[model samples]
Target chain A: MIVRPRLEDHLVIGKYTGKVIVGVGLLMVIPLLVSLGFGEWDTAVDFVISISACLIFGFGTQLFCRTEKDMNWSHGLVVASGAWVWATALGALPHYLSGHASSYLDTLFDVMSGYTTTGLYLLQDIDHIANGLNMWRHLLTYAGGQGIVVIALTFLFKGTSGAYKVYVGEGKDEKLLPNVVHTARAIWLVSLTWLVVGTAALTATGIWLGQMPIRAFFHAMWVFMGAWSTGGFAPQSYNTFWFHSLTYETICIVIMIAGSFNFALHWAMWTGNLKEIRRNVETISMFVTLSVTTLAATFWLAKANVYPDAMSLLRKVFYQIVSGHTTTGFSTVYAKAFVTQWGPIGLVVTTIAMAIGASACSTGGGIKGIRMGIMSKAFLQDIRRMVSPESALVSQKYHHIRDVWLDDGLVRGAMTITVAYVTIYAVATIVGVLYGFPLDQAAFEAVSAASNTGLSCGVTAPTIPALMKVTYIASMWLGRLEFMSVFALGGYLWSVVRGR
Target chain B: MMTRTRTLTVLVVSGAMLAALAAPAFALATYPPNKPDSTELINHQNVLGDVTKGLFWNGKAITFHGEAIGEVMVRGDYAWIHLNDDAYMVENIEEGAKLGGYNSGMAVWVPSALTKQIDTYGDYQHEGSIVSIAGVFNGACKQHGGDMDIHATSLRVLAAGHVVVDPVRPWKVVLAVVLASIAGLLFWFERKYRYLLRQSGRVGT
Candidate 1:
């Protein structure tokens, strides 16, 4: 029997969603201070207006939807998904007010992309945008990478038990500690520690590469944010290519690989479980997939004579493959070069890498390495069972934070999510093809969006069919939330319309 | 003899006119000139579009023009400067220019001495110097770890850049003030609502 949500259910969802909105408003203060620091009065006004709007909506919702009821599972799922929609809508104010995006929809797309850590953008004249706006863009990725729900859990939510449900709804199921709030803080500690070290290294490299000290510092901070989040939002249009330095690319590579690691793995390493790095299934899976993709891409490029020599081949092929595998969209080449230079084989190899993506419970998005590891072991166990006696027992074991034997439910769950990812990727690709893009290019872009890898092959632009833009937006949202939460949100809305 | 002379002279003149008429068509059929016409110069999108359609401009000398954006980063005898040819090059967003599209630009590697002619670079505060350069475009420069760049042989500043004064709009200021006041009132109400909930030991749906 279908049961409609009660008034308290609505209140609980609204109250929690308001708290998230408040957090979004608080986040604007960083950029607001930045604009004031640079004496960008016009830009400062944009933030002020945006901040004010956020506060009004957030506070008004809280005041009106006051309730003592704690969030249940459905409320948590709805809040997690619903908060993203609100955040994206409100968060776009700064981008729109800057007069950069072509329209309000474009701004929403950019904000959603930023929050999902998908780096595709449609902001016009990014080079001419204010420093504060640039700060906000990169900051969006950094905060988004930590998961907005995680941020809310860390500070706003006083109730502990229900908080974990919301945290799980954000697609981060692994807890580094027993308490969800502690887990959120631990994620922050890992990110902040990397921020300092990574920013300093990149700053030095930028200065050595002849950028002015101030410019180097700001670029370093922005790039560090982009790389650490695997969000790939470089301050300039040229992306990492603007620097044109090997050292900068190397630093980005290191940060990107590290950032793609699971938070639990980081905790293990931080707490003296050094051997965990070697025996971890996710790491092993990542290494194998990266090696295969890199080899395939390198071979393809070598045959095409894309680069003149070995070093160029290594730099171009290896870097791009790693960027794709980590699901970071930072590119050293122009967008069209993939179509012009890399050819179809190179494109397919990269698409595969992006589809496999990085570790589970990390900033990255895709099928996830942990799932791949389990599925591979499952396949191996199945093959062994086929050859053995019919009554004999066959089990597959994988090491994550600890050794675990894969069960039928675990494999089924992994397969379901993987199927969901593949389905979305195909749907998005078909939409792109309907818009008259080449099949290979469409597939590449669709997978890129669906996997939250922001690499583009000249298809993503302001002038693309608005329908295609919406499709990519939906893909990014679904892929980031891993489908389940969004499904729950859909069911809740349907029930509201037709429940008995 | 006089008639023959007249006929030959007329024929010679006719032949000369016909030759002149055919020359332009012949020239059009021949290979295009190395120097690009100012009106027909390729923009970023054109170059990118061509590449996306499977055309390579590697090792090809081309002409590109745009506003010199950001700062010139010097490395040895050559410096790297990004040139933006987007709509905001002449007027900016703050100056009430309609949004065109995303910034489309190319990276140029010019001699350090040539960059001196560029006085200003575009940012939030100023419009950058507009410069045109003739260069060899690399699809992937082997020297710079396969980066897409242009190695320029010549540069000319077409327009001098000046500071753009972007005074805050009065309407925005007024709107901001109004919104901030409303937000403050709402915050107070929110706190009061929470307080009432606590005091009553139950909350309204």
Candidate 2:
């Protein structure tokens, strides 16, 4: 049956879309107040201007586009993309006013990085920034990781149609619970609980390791949210290197893993069904990937004399491997130091982990592990068919929780998209190289930026060529939306403007 | 056997020397002594003697010929001037050659009373040109970190000239343009096949 698209669907989605934007504007007020509380007058002023601007636009959209309708696919795409752009523009206010960033463009880069949970920063001296403002930066990561739309949909919207559109538009394909609202709430609750417990544990470790009490507490809180959300903005200027203890690294490891787990699994555990833990395809794949990568990296680091002993080797390997695979972007070992010592192979493996990214339905960014699992299953089936006798007929089926037959169309589609992603990734790297970055460093930075991983080989700086900065920005944008939404938004714009 | 041992020792020593020479280059480069550390550096009130090692205010580089008290102010360029006795503004005397201290190009505001002694002893202009200042050796004054200005009792300006303002270099412009072009290209591609891209997911089913 052909389902004709309706204007009412678009209008309904547009109304909620406006509300979501307005909600984001309201959220901006919290950070604005925080900046003011710290006596960062300039930052406070900038936030005021930004909040006012956002409120004007957001509320104006709602007021003008009031309708009693539901959202369509096109409406969902527009709302999602428009919200991100608006958030990025408004979020740059604090960075711009803080005076750490050199230019408005640089501030946008940093803000995009934070909101996208990429963890790349243009701010030079984070240590000196006011406490309240610093907290706001990490808060953006936390909010962005779960998605502002998801939060708004769960808390504000009651209608099933609106919630479903927003849910899918926010890139959450799987519903852990029967009700979309319940699933969203459960995800947030589980994440929040982990955040609190993780913060307390890390804070204790920080104090024990001799960090100043207040600073330690704040650092722990920010790092915990960032890691558990896989957001990656560290409170200190040194990033994760400030807490140079194995205990600190281990805590982060757990947080990253927790952040990268599919929320459906968390909800299942919440319902006292522990068997869901064993059955998750994404989780199992992630675990296997983590183990293999960590061991390999550890061996490589030891061989290169980057780590002196087995314990030190494990610490570096495990921390970095987890950071990359989870797309958390926190680093115990400085990338600049590691790149110089470990050479090409080290960079390549880490890049692969970042590109593979974390489990779907989690906060982490990238192509996601579930998609990779599907691709891998299809690849194996193809191999099986090739090995079978010419005259023999075979039907291949794969089992996860249930048996599913593999088809050529499924395999072809996945491969096509994967290739498209790779092409985008390669172009970004090539741009970096064209701008005079060494080949390895260029590739590493490109992958990190595109995956929204924020792991750096010391190439990302304010001084980096403007062309390269723009490339990184595109990568971050595409990565956060998983590329598809961005494309849809582009098409929508073209259709409107060009009558195509 | 003795010659062989001597050669091995020489080879080892040379290898160690080569490694040592290469190590600093491989490590992340620190800013030169005068360049400000973005994190720890701040501008605060300090005595002239204390300001010798740290960042210099504006154009004024101070050397302690003798103890002086006055308010110090950093001007537009790398010139720092202190006013001596009398807690008021005055014209500053040009001192010697080098501008001493960190050159992060940030201005510090301080009281004129600090430069009273120098105002009385040296050439002082009362047109609010020179002020007394005292501050610690904070490396750089960024917006995030609080201001860095040294307290002074004397007024003196080493020299004055057209302080060169550095523009955003050409390389940065080139880099930015290149990046923007790539973004434009991506935007174009995304617009082109958006339907195919979006429907590809459902197409498998």
Candidate 3:
């Protein structure tokens, strides 16, 4: 039996969601101040309008729908989902106003891409953009990578359990402290510490590469934000090619690998538990997958003789495979080169890596490592059952923060989300084929989009069909949220349309 | 008398016609630059092969006005420089505010001697040198991993670029002032709430 949610339930959600939105508005002040400092008055005005709109809409919603009712799990999920939708819509104002994006839809696509940490962009004239707008671009990825809701938990929301609910609903399960807010702070603390170190190192390298100190610092900070978030946005149209330094590439590679590590792993490392780095289930899984994918891509490229030498092959082909695997989407090769240079085998290896993705509770999206671990366990268990005695009993255990014994419920959850991800990837591929894109390119791009990996095989441009654009957008949203909140939103909408 | 007058008129007319034909030739002799003796003239689109393959211009010396984009990537004796001759351009930094659409560019490897004249590189803040290059374009170069590139035989900066000055809009000041005031109001309200809470002993001061 289904109990239709009353209108009052929505009011409760609106109140909390409005709180998150207000937090987002306040967060805009950093960029606003940056633009003002840089005297990028055009970008400043756009931020002013956007910031004002967020505050007004947020306060108004809270004023009208203010509720004393305690937030349930459903209410928390609704608020989290609502916050993302609102964030994407209102967050798009800066991109749209900047005149870089073609339209409101394009801005929305880019905003969602940033917030989801999917590095795909519909932004044009990136090289000529103001410092302030560029700051906002990288900032969105950084903030979104940790999560806006998590920020709200630290300062805005007062309730403890309700805050935890919202956190869980945002597709995060790891908690470093008994208090969720403390955990949020710990995550930020780790990230900020890395940020300072990474930025300083990168800035030095940038200066060495002949950039002015100020420009070097700016590039360092933005690139750090992109890398730390695994967001993959570069300040120039050529992306990483602008710097053209091997040192810069190496630093970014380190950052990308580190960024894809789970916050739990970071917490363990912060303590005396150094073994956590090796023994973690996600680490082992990453090792296996990375080796397979990297080797497969290298051997294929070597056979094809696509690149001239070992250096070129590693720089162009290996880096891309690593980028796809980490879901970092930092491409040294041109977008079209996926089709032209890498060829079929290279694309397949990249597609597999993209689908496998990075560690769970990290700044990456796809079928996470923990789930893959569980799935592998389940496969082994089934095979053991088939071969052994009828009464044979085998138990599986995986080390995360602790030993997590595999259960039916865990398997079900893992399998369900994995199936959902695969289904969406397949659907997007079919739609791409229907639109006349070649088969392998479609599959590669589909997996890229659905997995929130920003690597493109040249299909995700402004010129693509409108339906395809929306399809990719939906795939990113669903994949990022891991399908639960979106399903809830869909169910709620359906109930409203049909129910008494 | 009529025969002599007719002969004088014909001589005068022929002299004027000869002078008129020789005028452009004299101007060409005094002109500052030697015309680059190249048959093919190309743009960024021709080098990048956007709508169609740029195979015809491949391995051919051509001349075009190209704006050096990004940094002059200094690699040993030679430099890898990117240049654009696209329709998308700003006459000045202020004019760049109204720019719409994407930036298109092509990479050219030129001797450092030629690139020394490039004082400014095109980016958000500064415009690069718009130089005309007589170079050979490789559609698929064995060097640089099949990248489409140009090897320049000669390069000349036709126009110089300056730092773009982005002016502050008046409305921005107004909004900033307004938002600051609102922020101030909120701060006061928060202080008042804390004062009341202190009076009520709900929290430690």
Alpha-carbon RMSD, each predicted model: 10.4, 19.4, 8.7
lDDT of 3 by residue, A1-500 (tens): 45677878888888778878888888888888988887777788878877876776676666567456767887777787878999889888888777677678888888888888888888877776778888888888898888888888877877556788788778788999888888888889999999999999999998777677888898899898888787778787667756656688889888888888899999999987999989998988888998899989988877766555777667766578778888888877667666655667788899999999988888888898888888898889888878888887877788998998889999999999999999999999999999999889999988888888888877887777888888888998888888888887777767767766
Task: Give fnat of each prediction, in order.
Answer: 0.66, 0.00, 0.20
Alpha-carbon TM-score of each model against the true structure: 0.91, 0.69, 0.85
lDDT of 3 by residue, B100-153 (tens): 444555667788888898887876667667777777776445566545567887
Poorly placed runs, candidate 2 (over 4 Å): A1-14, A36-42, A389-405, A408-410, B1-205
lDDT of 2 by residue, A291-406 (tens): 87777776666665544356655666677778999999998544564465445677878888888888777888777776677787777766877999987776765434345676
Best by DockQ: 1
Give the docking tier of candidate 1: acceptable
Ranked by TM-score, the better of candidates 2 and 3 is: 3
Q: Return the DockQ of model 1.
A: 0.31
**Native-referenced DockQ of model 2:** 0.02
lDDT computed for candidate 2: 0.62
Candidate 2 docks at the CAPRI level of incorrect
> Which TM-score values does chain B get in all models?
0.67, 0.28, 0.65
Interface RMSD of each: 3.7, 18.9, 5.7
Q: Which candidate, 2 or 3, would have the higher DockQ against the true structure?
A: 3
Runs in model 1 deviating more than 4 A are B1-56, B197-205
